[model samples]
Target chain A: MTFLSASLEQSPSTAEEEAYLYLQRGLRLCRYKPGDRLIPEEIAAEIGMSRMPVREAFRRLAAEGLVTLRPNRGCIVAGLTLDEIYETFEIRSVLEGLAVRLAVPKMDADAFLDLERLLDRMERAGQTGSSDWVVRHQEFHALIYTLSGRPNLIRKINALHVVIEPYMRFWFDYVDKPLSAREEHERLIRAFAQGDALHADQIMQEHILGTAPLLAEFASPVRR
Target chain B: MTFLSASLEQSPSTAEEEAYLYLQRGLRLCRYKPGDRLIPEEIAAEIGMSRMPVREAFRRLAAEGLVTLRPNRGCIVAGLTLDEIYETFEIRSVLEGLAVRLAVPKMDADAFLDLERLLDRMERAGQTGSSDWVVRHQEFHALIYTLSGRPNLIRKINALHVVIEPYMRFWFDYVDKPLSAREEHERLIRAFAQGDALHADQIMQEHILGTAPLLAEFASPVRR
Candidate 1:
């Protein structure tokens, strides 16, 4: 029931929770693209549940900004405007900046190993042009933020990532791979190793801000 | 309904919206203090409605971290551990720091005048030991952050403020007035006026962090 991240590791305890997770994963992975309508009955039949849990899931997703609930119409996948996409990146910059600043002091050898593993996975995904690259990209940042030990801050930052992930997926799918992204993250890891919180904070903010304009420009042509 | 802030300016469009706002205001203002059980029937009676809307409100408030929804026990006002209080302040420090950093460039003669007016009202509320002081204090900060022109970021920051305001009210109610709060804010305004975003950011973060230990200490004895 925790909306902190998109992790599917935990099993759902309730039908509504199950429905929510199913729909959320679908939305996050761009299975339900922006402007797609979600019919409660259709989703309920698909999930083999009554319509009520699906309706409740819609409300929860609406609260999370993952979907829009219309008065008479059904739920629609929430799309960010070009401006909204940039605004989200700006917000994520400051929040994830705070994350790495706090995280650097707490990063131990184990955390560094986990970071390296995720980096390796991302590089592999990038070479294969696998969609898993976007997910690994997210996990790499999530791993760093989780070390901050501030659950509330990490939760808020992860929610932003959830809202913006589809757009990121869209950018990666249609546009060319970011050639500098790996280099930037490598520099970021080096900065983290230095244990300079402020320096790491700057690097993290710039790392997030670095992707904003590229996504904005790519998303501009396709408003949906 | 907008979960932006505790603004009662707009009329509610639905029964659920009405109940949500009422409960939100009560929780934020400490009318229903931490750990208080909110019975749907009682609140529905007070609002002249059925229990359905009140229950819906409980779900929304639960999503907001203002209340805990036990499976069989209904809703209870959420109580924070001492660690949570400190953690929230740290989160607010960075978010509000970003706020002022963005807000400085947007400040103008009119905005300065508005800030002075709110400060005046806050001073009067403090002198009278009026409960309105907590509200005015929120307004002062909200005024600055609103100038950020980033609605999503502002919305997220305001949600954190909503979660922390009751504790602030508890501190001010039980402990002495912050004698230096006004002076600290004055210094913040001066920093903002200088248009040095980094300095203003630092001041804002420190100003928020400055209050954390004091509130934590005061709330420690009464972990209700």
Candidate 2:
């Protein structure tokens, strides 16, 4: 509610945070389309602020892979080429698989069962088949990351998450079948519960990257 | 030269890029130390610009991992932890390993000679033992990314490059000798000439994580 603000009136810390908030909201709502011109004055006006903080927000968003900085050309709203998307997911699949591998030795029975609860919640969320549910499903996987105890790895994984946001949005736009994604999650949960790191790694890797691009052609020049 | 300006002029693009340049310079000089405060007026004043453009630059820098957004606190210069350094180098080592592996099969004799020339230049640079030469030596390694022929991978690799800057500076500060790093470069160039992917990867992996607070007793806190 707070950090993920819909408006920019009063962010807790500084003008920069407020600036970042407006842009984050814009990105989440698909208001700032891929390859859109991101004018500071426009964003600042939208958030009922000046250009100061919004400029700051743009910086973090760039780091998050939502914006690009080029010479001659300034910042543009960033989109993943199909190649970048594939690369991002492939790298993430291995890293998450690594996380899952690390988590196995540390996972207790309760943690296994807790994940089941998340799966069920995701299933329930899927009944509405809302974008909200997809986000919740993403969070469920993030919980698995928490068990791994590697903040360093987690940061890189988060970067990948940001990189693919738009394509994920497009995927949900066309795909009416929620059951497939949910099914994938259920299968992944089962693999994790068995404490089979190799299988779990392979399963999760496929679950994250294999299916994501197949839902649509991410690398097509038209998307660029 | 235009990008080097600290002042934000009346023009929008000029102002915005000037802002970016300010932070970039600040980062280069370590003026914005990890955890340093980022006040809009302060930045604007120092850059000889209005708060608006400086705000814009802050956003860009935050995205680049040069600054941290503190919710209500505004922007603070971002800091790199030792753990982050390790994880970053680990990922870079893997990606670069992948890069050179891809490049190795396709490396023409001319390219092999090019790699040798780069190494020789670096060795000559290393013999002079100037920090500036060492920095350029680092750039010689970076040119390998472009040879990989994957723009997306290069961007990711470059992102990794920015993330490691502060820590690498710390590393240069600590190491008593520069010759060993240069010698490793020579060995690496030879490995690349032989099309030795495994050996190149091995040397690179060591070359990167070599900064691992390997000597446990030497793991002192990074004093501000």
Candidate 3:
């Protein structure tokens, strides 16, 4: 197989590519369900565009491991078993633990300030049980990547978010008694301010894995 | 914006996607320098294809963080600073260390035997200093992931592999030194066989981080 050319300059531009991103977003949002046979023509007709763009979108998703590309088999949404979900958490536990540790030392005044702002927002959102908290809360932690000074580490952690996202939101939205995510975030910020790496790490670990216990068997594939 | 999606199933089989994969592979091999601006049409022509697939390829690379998207501004192959590289290794060190720790106790005779077989292959490949040995060496360690019992952890590590591939391959190919890798792998395998998790973990931690000293300068945009 050919290696990555690394020539960022040679890539072409096209409407198909833009169309792919649109479809990718749609698919990721479950507008396209697993095992759903996607005819490029159908999508194009729906979007009132040509089939070309939709096809590019599918190719991109396939590359991201979100869709399967069977030569003759067409495509399907990538599915994860219970075991796979638990294993993802197992890995997330370690990666997030490391991320928190790195984030602690680099938790500067600005980082803490932003984090405080976010934590406050999360507290308010949590009281109302709004999805906005969930979104901002992700950004709040992503800020830690800037603090941790580790793009590589952050990248790994970010990918974990992609895999677990479906379950995370579901648990928060559908579970009978969702977590007090605000409390967890609040505890984490306090840990960060204290500059306690181990404590912060532990709290983040619990904060993340703590969600596993509440995931419903059928609704969420992830296991504890 | 997507919580977690498994939708959409349209793929435009364009030459651009193929070009993207080809270009992506080249980047992994360091074929293109950082900050290179790719002309989509030119690349499409050169590859005997249309601009569509090449555009899709660029989109995917940008998503992977290998290249940055400038909107209409164009693309730049990402360059990892020394700090970024270190962070990558540091987190990888711990995560892989955790993987080894989790894997060590789980290895039975059959697994040890397979690992030993892989180790022997590495030694031979090291002696000859062949590129294939280096590739297989990765596979050898991949075998250990089975012991990891966590597919998500394995995938995360593999993702790191994709990110660091260019730098690692460039360094080793240029350095003409693969002996250190040989020694470290040997020690690590021995620790596993001896059922010493701490010892194995320590050896791994050192071995993983040890690459920094050899490859740090190469990781940057300016070669030292």
Interface RMSD of each: 1.8, 3.2, 4.3
How much of the true contact map at the interface does candidate 1 reproduce, as a fraction?
Answer: 0.40
Least well predicted 10-residue stretch by lDDT in candidate 2 chain B: B1-10
lDDT string, candidate 3, B3-99, tens digits: 0111112333546546865676667767776777777887889889887767767767776667776767776787677777787788778778878
lDDT of 2: 0.65
- Predictions: Cα RMSD each: 3.3, 5.7, 7.5
Which ranges of candidate 1 are over 4 A from the true structure? A1-6, A35-37, A70-74, A120-129, A132-135, A221-224, B1-6, B31-48, B70-74, B120-135, B221-224
Lowest summed lDDT across 10 adjacent residues in model 1 chain B is found at: B1-10
Candidate 3 Cα errors over 4 Å, as ranges: A1-21, A113-140, A151-156, A178-190, A216-224, B1-21, B39-47, B67-77, B120-136, B149-152, B176-183, B194-202, B219-224
In Å, residue A110's CA in model 1 sits off its true spot by 2.9
* Candidate 1 local lDDT, B52-96, one digit each (tens): 768767766876688987767778999789888988888888878
TM-score of model 3 (CA atoms):
0.76
- Local distance difference test values of all predictions, in order: 0.80, 0.65, 0.68
My TM-score estimates for the predictions, one after another, are 0.88, 0.73, 0.76
lDDT ranking, best first: 1, 3, 2
Candidate 2, residue B43: CA error in Å? 4.7
* Pairs in clash, predicted candidate 1: none
Clashes of each: 0, 17, 25
